[model samples]
Target chain A: AAGVIQSPRHLIKEKRETATLKCYPIPRHDTVYWYQQGPGQDPQFLISFYEKMQSDKGSIPDRFSAQQFSDYHSELNMSSLELGDSALYFCASANQGLYNEQFFGPGTRLTVL
Target chain B: DQQVKQNSPSLSVQEGRISILNCDYTNSMFDYFLWYKKYPAEGPTFLISISSIKDKNEDGRFTVFLNKSAKHLSLHIVPSQPGDSAVYFCAATVYNQGGKLIFGQGTELSVKP
Candidate 1:
């Protein structure tokens, strides 16, 4: 079973505060992806990491940043969170294959007050 | 700038009936397609997939049909069950794009007993 584990299944924070979310990819997977899912909307790509280096980032605000560690764990940081920043964050991982399947973790729901 | 679209916001089906979910993409570069299902408070899970090389691919009760010429895809679930009630999102990846997937606005499916 391919499973990605995410920390803080639910979170609440005040506006202007910083929030950090963590994701641990499935073992043996080299790629990790972060996405933001707003209310009543589809999930949008945030960034992707491969081999400990940042590969790509979507059109997100500069306040959003991510890091991939040597152990293949990734963290997403939001600086100065706004009310609009409240949403569900999902982490996905896949191995090295052209047609590799990406598996997801139960998302972290952030509610900015 | 929404590349993928799922016009329907929700669907209701009787148990044991077939449920069909559709998706369309404006990008011709998208060659790989996937369907994901998400239960409440859970991240999306891979349900099925189809490559551009084939028009249809089936796994057990789930089948995905891809029409490259039309730049469209559909997922069919046979004998839908109450457990299948969830939000379904259709995703597409460009060939050799490091498995980055762009998703469509999800459709909520409700199966009646």
Candidate 2:
């Protein structure tokens, strides 16, 4: 089975720079979710989309923005990045009518200096 | 306030023994639950799950139990193997709430051979 795919498995950036992460959800999956995991902490919800529409928001920073394209792939764009933004970013996908099992992709490790 | 919590930071178990991981949640509105296993530098892999309506669900050597009254859930891995050593996370979602998952701080499980 095809799993969710995320780009830039690892990233290094300086403070105040901009970064964009992309996610390709499993084929035919309609919902995409983004999460951030700090060292030794639980994965924190960032934002989510369903069928290219904004579905929900969590603790995502004001500098961060995301959108799901018509192809069902999602992108997270971060501007004026800060050191505190260093963490593992993950993307997950699920089918709504099939119930709730969201399959996650290999995360992108972002290190901001 | 942390809605989902894994109180134990780590656990060690002998190979071939049963490994149990516990998770608690303060949110009674959560209706779906899941367990995920993660290795270093990788995304979480879905393991097992039990819904709020089901007390138990099993798949091969893995089982998940849910106690709605206590807002608690547990994952049981029988005859654990060294390969099973990894970080395990517990997550929950409200059925009607956009399918965003609330994750617990993961517990590291070491299965010694």
Give the 10-residue window scoring lowest on summed lDDT in candidate 2 chain A: A94-103
Window of ten residues with lowest summed lDDT in model 1 chain A = A93-102
TM-score winner among the candidates?
Answer: 2
**What stretches of model 1 exceed 4 Å from their correct place?**
A98-100
DockQ scores of the candidates: 0.69, 0.78
Candidate 2, superposed: residue stretches over 4 Å from native: none
Alpha-carbon deviation at B76 in model 2, angstroms: 0.5
- C-alpha displacement of A18 in model 2, angstroms? 0.4
lDDT of candidate 2 over A1-113, digit per residue (tens): 78899999999999999999999999999999999999878899999999899999999999999999999999999999999999999999999764368899999999999
Compose the digit string of candidate 1's lDDT tens values, residues B1-113: 88899989899999999999999899987778889999878899998888878999999999988887888889999989999999999988877777778999999999999
Candidate 1, residue B111: the lDDT equals: 97
Go through the candidates in order and give each one's C-alpha lDDT: 0.90, 0.93
**Against the hidden true structure, what lDDT does model 2 obtain?**
0.93
